[model samples]
Target: MIDIQFRREDSNIMSVEMSGHAEAGPYGYDIVCAAVSALSIGTVNSLSEIAEIPVEVVSANDSGGYLKFTLPTDLTQKQMETGQILMKSLYLSLKSTEEEYNEYLRINSLDGK
Candidate 1:
């Protein structure tokens, strides 16, 4: 199973952390993992390319399957709004995937809001 966590602060998402493998299929054929990787990497790229927000991202170099994305502290007001939109889009997309593949994917919001 894959565990995806969303961390929020002051009603805004502060970071997103994803770990674990979605053993829904064999290596190179896990659709759930692919969906999640695409969403996460795409969000990072969009934050840099579209929102012009330089976020801090960390990924596991080992085999544990871990990725964390955190927003930078110097974003302008507009950038913050745009970044939120992109992040929310990612969250909703992951939620939809979780709805379909509940056995393979799990999403938790730390803020519970």
Candidate 2:
């Protein structure tokens, strides 16, 4: 199962962490994992590439099935908005995924109002 946690700060997303595999199918054929990966990686890319604000803390371990990212403190208003939009989009996508693949995924929102 995939354990995904969204850390919030004052109702805003502060960070995101995900671990484990969906195991919905074979390694190359797990649609759940692929969808999750696309959301997470796409969020990062959008924040950095499109928003021009690079996330200072990002880690990934393919073999261990882990990925984490934290928003930087110095982002400008536009960048922050961009990041939040992408993250919220991710949250919605993951929520939908959870609804469809509840057996292979778990999502938790932590420490944010």
Q: What is the TM-score of each candidate against the true structure?
A: 0.93, 0.90
After best superposition, candidate 1 residue 53: deviation in angstroms?
Answer: 1.0
- Writing each residue's lDDT as its tens digit, candidate 1 over 1-113 gives 88888988786787899999999899899999999989999999999899998889899977858999999877899999999999899999999999999999999775743
Best by lDDT: 1
Per-residue accuracy of model 2 over 29-100 as CA lDDT, tens digit each: 999999998888888888778878777555565475888888887778888888888888888899999999
> Could you give me the TM-score of model 2 versus the true structure?
0.90
Over 4 Å off in model 2, which ranges? 62-64, 110-113
Q: After superposition, how far is residue 16 of candidate 2 from its true place, in Å?
A: 0.5
Alpha carbon RMSD to native, model 2: 1.7
What is the overall TM-score of model 1 with all chains considered together?
A: 0.93
Q: lDDT of all the models against the reference?
A: 0.89, 0.84
The lDDT of model 1 is: 0.89
In candidate 1, where is summed lDDT lowest over 10 consecutive residues?
104-113
Model 1, residue 97: displacement in angstroms? 0.3
